[model samples]
Target: MGQKINPLGFRLGTTQSHHSFWFAKPKDFPAELQEDERIRDSIKNYVQKNLMKVSSDFEGIIRIEIHKYKELNTTQVKIDFGRQNLLTREEEEEKDDKEEKKKLELLKTKAKIIIQLIPEPYEEPHILAEYIALQLKNRIPLGKAMQKVIELMEETDIKGIRIQIAGCIGGKERAHVQWIREGRLPLQTIRAKIKYCSYKVQTPHGVLGIKIWMFVDFVDEEFVDFVDEEFVDEEFVDEE
Candidate 1:
């Protein structure tokens, strides 16, 4: 079984060594910086600069990545935060587990200040993630919760979003899977370009595994046309 969910608001409580995120979409970036790669670099630089300014003691590496979606009009920015200089395993082991955990939590909280550097439009995903975390705090039915998430994303520029939750749901003994999606289904393919995020939300019943898949957009119309043509050809062959 998965570890129990961290306490509420414990976004950084997991054993993850790094926290990374991709801005949902580009909004209002300068014309020259509109490209996904450029936007990713700009956001990474902006975040690093802002964090450095606030925390002179902070010294970490930030990596920026831009994933091309489909033919290139759609792009996703991925940013990774490295835990360099945070602490060594030896040093961490020297402290009590609880004390070390608290220290790490504080460090993460300080690191999270970088969230404020994100601008509007692009910040929608972050807000949506927070919303999901908050809404799952209570014992709402899994289907209902996923439906609510779909409703929330329908209003955004997200071309496609999928949410999957697994675990002892509704206080049942047998673990189950529940999921929902809005817009295009996130297909696994070279052209689909899906970015993912995972979180563990603790509930009255047990820890619910939350997985989010964000897609650049629907599959190309050309692909859809090809699929239809193949279907028609197969139907014709069957009629023979």
Candidate 2:
């Protein structure tokens, strides 16, 4: 904020006083005359007479009202001016860079995945367990949900198995895996559709959608147990 002050102002009644006058006087004047009141009076009268003549000769004389005005020294005003110029430039660049970085980070953390499962009749529990293991394998590494599914089918002598694999979409950090085996007809079907269909997940900060499709052989109880015992524990601990 800038202060508003009156310009051309007088202080201590100094305006119109003789103390404000400047004149060129001869240096050769007698030393004694310099201190003489009569000499001083003569010099004042001479300067005043010429000043009056010059004022009268002018076509128009404008009188301005005087008020006290705050004066900023050259050095102080220069420092302030430089700071204003620098801040204007810096603010614009900083704003642009911040927006660009935010966009790049958003691109990096986007979430996506695909899963496929083949459920066997008379083996619902084993199939569900195998699907869970497969989901965990996809989430982790070096484990095969599809391989376990295949093994289970081979052991049970089931043929022509086809399980619908669903897509789950959410923030990588907050995504949850859920299993459902039974429910009201419509609700169960809806859940299966959602799990299979491409889904758009919303978070407080942003949104991401994913498409998924997968195929596997059979469920392996041992592999599922391993995932439950080892991989899940590691994931939770690592997150903590």
Candidate 3:
């Protein structure tokens, strides 16, 4: 009277009802998009990143297909759980269909995706970007700007920093890029917490891209604290 369970713990012959599905079927979504082969890779990548909680699920590979139609240029997405044996219909399951429908009704309310559009309200980059923007508005020379920014960042707990600016600087026609840094380079170093931000500076010369990196290891003993050298006194008399 009991059903068999698959190796993955999924109950065999249990029909996965549309009502109990993961993704919500939007009204404008085209049902035929499920069958389209062209956009399969795109849909798979998007779903793998945004949906499917388990990384192990990627090994089995969730199949997703998308189709675009010219009638108002709408897009439809289809998802396949990619479990092959479960695809076949079993006659015994048909007898339990009514019972399954009743169970689905109980579970349908729980099936939903809660997406957090703004996960972090106060990110560090916002503050850093604003500081740099305020500094660049002075129309100072590239080297002077870099030095001033480094001086400003020294007051903070940042371990290391780098700033790079490119394009025709100081009203010159030729384009060039130069970078300045204090302490270790954040990107190249291994096992260091690093924060990165970039901003564009529009000036009379040309547009300049400003990249900032703030290394976050404040209490790191290697950089800030050190051991003093041992001093010894030797007896000297003959020479005197």
Number of the top-ranking candidate, with lDDT as the measure = 1
**Model 3 CA lDDT for position 139:** 65
Which structure among the candidates has the greatest TM-score?
A: 1
TM-score order of candidates, top first: 1, 3, 2
Q: Which stretches of candidate 2 lie over 4 Å from their true place?
A: 1-122, 129-138, 141-143, 168-240
lDDT of 1 by residue, 89-177 (tens): 65333322433243234322111111112222221333344446556675455667667777766766677887777888778899999
lDDT of 3 by residue, 1-240 (tens): 565222112211221112111232576345433323324444345434533343323212232322232332233233334323222244223413432343234323111111112222112333344445445566655577567667767776666777666777667788887888887743433334555556666666567776666666522333321111111011111112
In the range 124-237, model 2's lDDT, one tens digit per residue, is: 323233343335434532124444544554565333233333334222456434322222212112112111223333333244332222222322322222111221223323
lDDT by candidate, in order shown: 0.46, 0.27, 0.42
Quote each prediction's TM-score.
Answer: 0.42, 0.18, 0.38
Point out the worst 10-residue segment of candidate 1 by lDDT.
Answer: 108-117
Count of residue pairs whose backbone atoms collide, per candidate: 0, 13, 0
